[model samples]
Target: MTDTVLEIKNLEASYGSVQALRGVSLSIQEGTIATILGANGAGKTTILKCISGIVDPRKGSIHYLGRAIGGKRADLIVRMGIAHVPEGRQVFPLLSVRENLWLGAYTRTSRVEALEDLEAVYRYFPILKDREKQEAGKLSGGQQQMLAIGRAMMARPSVLLMDEPSLGLSPKLTEEIFTIIRRINRDWGTTILLVEQNASIALQTASHGYVLESGRIVMEGPCEKLFQDEGVQEFYLGQKEETGVERRRWKKTRKWA
Candidate 1:
């Protein structure tokens, strides 16, 4: 039997009057990577924020490791073994690389264990090791992304929530990051819930996928199945060879649900 490590059911959230998530529900199995694919403003980031307790859900339940964690504080959620690597690589620019990574272990009780985790992060990102004393802002965009991910790992989380890890990155850098993400899941046994606009890479890296549109889950299935789907091929993967007219016609007739 597949063990579900995280589950979000009928989740609803909003920013003031603007509703961001409308009953979004999904589950991630233990020790696997799950990807959420969507366009901008589709509430993909909102889901991760809700899970990480950065945004409070107005309704629904969030379960991690069979425990209810809805409405918990963000720091409390992190201490409960979930770490969120937020969008836009929000590393503290003024802090040194080592200092930024050390902050991820704020919830940890043992200093020795935190130090060991820091070494593990360095192993995954050797560039970070070389720049340990340098200010985080001095690094390039890709290096900052590496630091963001490494800092998350320093938390020693069982479940990692990553939002738009490929945003603003070159293709080569994006590939490298995804490769490291796969390695993190495979080698460290950490379950990941990844939100990405790069649908092709997300589908390829994850074992299962969910498609979100306008604050709701529109479709979901195994990654291979989603990759081969005609609509997904056209809308997400750019695999459709049809002319513009045919594309419009298909959209007019297609039912997203």
Candidate 2:
């Protein structure tokens, strides 16, 4: 079997006349965490949308496990072992936590196996187990985010697409969530494609990284290289050296594509 789990080539998409992704391409290796980092409106979320079938690519191809999956329906994609934990932690407000998690296994037929997976999810996020019968809407933001991830876990995906998993979270909660994400990757061996604005946490969490700017990939490399790059340090990592010297030096040396 090939090591690459997901591949995108020349991907282009838009909303009406406004283009969101322009000739974007990237790859995720099996059993590794990969991240896409960019500012707001940089087409970060759009890439995840296209992969999960929420939006169709106007051009190019998306291959999952060496098979093209660009135009498949979202539900079909989920059943094919790709689960999406969307940007906004979109949990069902009125549904009990247990009910929401069960809905994630809607594609599966074996009740016994699904129950076992449910127990595993509880083990991963013990708080979800504590709030099993509570209304999902009543949970704290951090708990709700946990629920969103738990819901995706119920699908038992081979590849997990997470968009802005740390949005609107306290620093402590964000660290906790990312810790769980790392454990999920290492323990379950699930391939992940994470999109985030929190560059520091994301770069630290992922093994490899892609930097997107205005709907295009500007930089791609291993996490350590990205973390050490002067440009990345100044722009993304919030490291500003004395009197803006490093910032100016970065601007002079780097050129965008």
Candidate 3:
């Protein structure tokens, strides 16, 4: 197996006349977490969409496991070993949790394989197991997000693309979600490319990081080192220019059920 999981060269994507990604290129190594941090409209989600084959890039190439995957259909990319957990945690509201999870592996070769995938998901999130027959719409936001991730896992993706998995969750639930993400990468060796608004935890958890502003990469480096950077402090770390590290931790309450 190759150490390099994903590579993009001079990638360009646009929505009509408005360009979102402008000649952006990056690499993700196997079994590592790569995070892209940017404000809204900075083309973070657009990049993932292009990688997952939902959006066609106007220029450049995307290589996954050493094969060109750009411009393919979304389902084709899913079968090619990339699973996407979109920003909204867009689970099927009317369906039961189990049914929604089942939909994730509709292209699996056999029922036995799908069952095994279900077992893997249950192991990662026992909470979903308890709510198997419950309506997905009735679940809390955090539970729904967990279901989204579990559904993605059913695809058995080599690379997981997550967009704003922390959105609309309390600080406590956010922490829990990020913890599970880190555990997933550590235990399963799943290469994850994450885009998050919560830069504090996102930067802390990722192995490598890229800072995007207005669709351009301003800085890129390892997470721990970037944690101490002045730009990361002023922007991501959520500190004032004059304020030193207060050694304060984000308060996480009891919320993940």
Top-TM-score structure, candidate number: 1
Residues 146-184 of candidate 1 have per-residue lDDT tens digits of: 999999999999999999999999999999999999999
Clashes per candidate (backbone, < 3 Å): 0, 0, 0
TM-score, one value per model: 0.96, 0.95, 0.92
- Per-model RMSD to reference: 1.8, 1.9, 6.7
Q: Write the per-residue lDDT of candidate 3 for residues 107-200, one digit (tens) a residue.
A: 6788898899899889888989999999999999999999999999888888999999999999999999999999889888899999998999
The ten-residue window of minimal lDDT in model 2 covers: 245-254
Q: Is candidate 2 or candidate 3 better by lDDT?
A: 2
For candidate 3, list the clashing residue pairs, or say none. none
Q: Model 2 scores what on Cα lDDT?
A: 0.93
Looking at model 1, residue 61 earns an lDDT score of: 99
| Full ranking by TM-score | 1, 2, 3
Per-candidate Cα lDDT values, in order, are 0.93, 0.93, 0.90
Greater lDDT among 1 and 3 belongs to 1
